[model samples]
Target: MNFHELLLCEGNTLEKEKGEHVFMQGDSDKSLYFIQTGLLKAYYTSSSGKEAIKSFILPNDFIGSLSSIYAGQNCSFSLVSLETSMLVKIPFEKIVEYGKKDIVLANNIIEFLMRLTLKKERREHEFLCMSAEERYLALIESTPILLKKITQNDLARYLGMTPVGLSRIKKRVQSKMSKQGENNP
Candidate 1:
């Protein structure tokens, strides 16, 4: 069967209220979730109590801890609902087991992992090569709608800046845009 068909037949629908956790860092939760609706955040917390956001998951995204599922390790980050979320939850092992017998299903899972890997690489590149202001600009261009949905604090965290720094960047960007707008017209 196909991945979607497999999900329909073998997965379970799970509902999470706002602020609920799908799994926590260092936990052994091993389910892969396909989001149907709502927003979720994946984040890591340092032993010193600093929290860093890994990424935000939107509808149609797949999220899971591969380490926990495939390697018998604990989750490296926590997944939590930012809003009431609907998701299809499937055991990672079950998917792998089915994939062994279904070429299409196996390929689909491989494609999903590849996409996730690319996204991670891009995020790493952004942090390593882009300035804070540039990252903010890219985020604006890519997901402006997300700005309205998330808090400024979360936005700053995602952009790898303090809230104050983000506010300054915002002011600078707006000022530049305003000047350009006046000159253009």
Candidate 2:
């Protein structure tokens, strides 16, 4: 079967409304999901009930399979729709079994996982090394379009900060830049 057809046959198509949750933090280890359209934000809720955005998946982005494929583990995060989303949910067992037989699917899964791993590693490095201003600029530069679509709260969470904290950081950066501009101009 073709990739899309295989996905359709093996998975259930789901439509999630905006602000509606697709899966909770500790849902099930049953199935995986592929994003055919729209956006999803994966997050972890802290002890203080603060939701931190781990990542955002856009069109053609894949999800749910990462923990299953890479760690043989249940989801470490919750997934929620940022907007109305169309997703294909595939059984985890079916994916593991299919990977044994289909070279195309196996390669696709490998490539997708590699990309995900690299992204996560990059974020880890940034978290440990980059300054707050540098991190904010890097995020803005990476997803320039997202600046408008995503909320400040979500962006703050992605940066591992509270909304108020992010606001202060933004103000500090702006003030510093403004002073620099005055000095130069």
Candidate 3:
């Protein structure tokens, strides 16, 4: 089942401008959000204020401080819009209230949460095992649309590479693609 459908039916819709923070680090809000349009980035800020991009959330994806919500603590990461966006914001309390009355909704929420966890785990493994070029190529293969939507700096950060490094990878990939096209032609 599409989790966004449930969110759209039950949650409050909110519009966010580009560069706006949906929820900042250390925020106490436990509201979950489903992106309906545009892009968002989840990031971590170090004590020295260096930002590290964790993930770029696209439309139909969910974003929130999951660990914080589970732990009853403040959010550890901030979610900011990379473009003007629309989102369905669902309060955690409301989810519990609704879940008590609906078993299917409860199961769907559990399944969605599990899928998120598994995706994160897969990404972690990829980072540990994949070269920077391989990681970038995999991203291109999986989410090419993101290349158009996100800034090079943000994409570099998401792939755990410097902007210059990412540039080199892009050049290499493009050159390879061009060579393949010429050969086929």
Candidate 4:
């Protein structure tokens, strides 16, 4: 069976309101969540209580703590609804069982993992090789809609900069854009 069919057949639906947490750091949640609508934020909280945005989970995305689900360890990050969200929750183990028996299911899982890995890799590259400004520009090109949906502070955190720094960058970008527009005209 296909992944969607599996989810519909075996998954439990949840309607989470804004600010509700799907799972927190150190929680053992072996479930994968398929977002049907709305947005979720996956973030990490340091022991000193600073929060770093890991990524945003958009509609049609699957999110889960891979380490927690596969290694039987505590979750490394927390997931929360940024807006009211509808999701389907399925046990990772259940997916694995089906994957082992169904080639189609196994291929789907592989495809999902590949996409997830590419996203992680791109994020790592952005952190290691790109400046905050460059990352911001890349975010605009790749996920412009996300900028409008998320708060400035959260966007700053995701871009690995302070909110004040982000403000400066935005001003610079806007100034440059206006100049370019004038020049073109």
Candidate 5:
């Protein structure tokens, strides 16, 4: 079954504004939220008073349910709407009952979790292996739409770079692209 149908069957839609939180770290782990529209970022603040992004969720993606899958654990990450977003919140009991009743739904949920995990892992790896410029380019190449939607500061934080460093990289990338265009012309 499709996402809307699933939501229609057993979930409620929530509307939230940009900068509003869907869930915070240490909140109850009783529900799974699916993004029907817009975006959400999962993050955690360190003891050093730093915020590190864990993952970004776009439309048709799931968030916050991972910690609940194995056992009901306190939220390990904060989920904030990056834009005014629409989310379908499904309670754990509803999903568990639905999964038991329908194999296809269970399979879909499993696949969704696996997809999210893989993407999160890739993001972590990029932070480790890619230079700031490379990571920035990769993000741009993958989600050019986000360039207009999110602030450079958030982008810098997501890429694990300082905002000033991001500014320098942005200028360099722009200059390089402009020169390439001139040369080609």
Candidate 6:
């Protein structure tokens, strides 16, 4: 069964409106959430109050304070819905209980966490190696759906660029594609 199905079997679900916070930075709650519908963003706020988006969680994505759960500390980031969303809220204690009894469920959770970790590592490498334009282009190529769903400001923050920079990159890429299409046709 899929992650959603697993969560449905074991967790409590809730509906959240756009702009609602699932959890805030420094929150002590260690609940794990699986998105049933819509989108959410995880972000970190610096002491100077600048926000940096960590990731966009889509349907079936698992999110929570994994590090905090393991370390027994407060959550390090904040989670907020980008649209009206449905989520399965699984308490950390429940996960532990399920893991102890269900090998398949435990393995699936491990795989999911590993995939998330790899994706984060890849994004870090891309940020370190790619130019602003290249990063935007790569994101568009890899996750075109995000272009339709996310706000320009949020997208820019996720890409580690300014809104103006993202705009310029989009215009440039569009112009380049248009020119290439015309020449090919």
Where in model 5 is the C-alpha error above 4 Å?
1-4, 68-71, 179-185
Write down the TM-score for model 6. 0.89
Best-first order by lDDT: 4, 1, 6, 3, 2, 5
What TM-score does structure 5 among the candidates reach?
0.85
Q: What is the lDDT of residue 87 in candidate 2?
A: 90
Name the best candidate (by TM-score). Answer: 4
In candidate 1 the C-alpha lDDT for residue 98 amounts to 98
TM-score of each: 0.94, 0.88, 0.87, 0.95, 0.85, 0.89
Clashing pairs in 1: none
**Candidate 1 lDDT, tens digit per residue, 68-161?**
9988999999999999999999998899899999999999988988988899899999999999999999988888989998988888888887
Q: How many clashes would you count in candidate 5?
A: 0
Predicted structure 4: clash tally: 0
lDDT at 80, model 3: 91
lDDT of 6 by residue, 1-185 (tens): 54555677878989999999998999887788888899999999989998889899999788898668888888889999999999989887877787778788788778888998899899989988999889888898899999999999999999997798889888999899889889573
Name the lDDT of candidate 6: 0.87
lDDT of 3 by residue, 1-185 (tens): 23555676779999999999998999888788888898899999889987789888888888889777778989999999989999999887778777787888889888987998899998998889999999998988888988988789988988888899999998998999889889573
Question: What are the root-mean-square deviations of the candidates from the true structure over C-alphas?
Answer: 1.6, 2.2, 2.9, 1.6, 2.6, 2.4
What is the RMSD, in Å, between candidate 6 and the native fold over all Cα? 2.4
TM-score of 1: 0.94
Reference-based lDDT, residue 74, model 4: 97
For candidate 5, list the clashing residue pairs, or say none.
Answer: none
Which of the predicted structures, 3 or 5, would earn the higher lDDT when compared with the native? 3
Name the runs in model 2 displaced over 4 angstroms. Answer: 1-3, 65-74, 183-185
**lDDT of candidates 1 onward, in order:** 0.91, 0.82, 0.86, 0.94, 0.82, 0.87
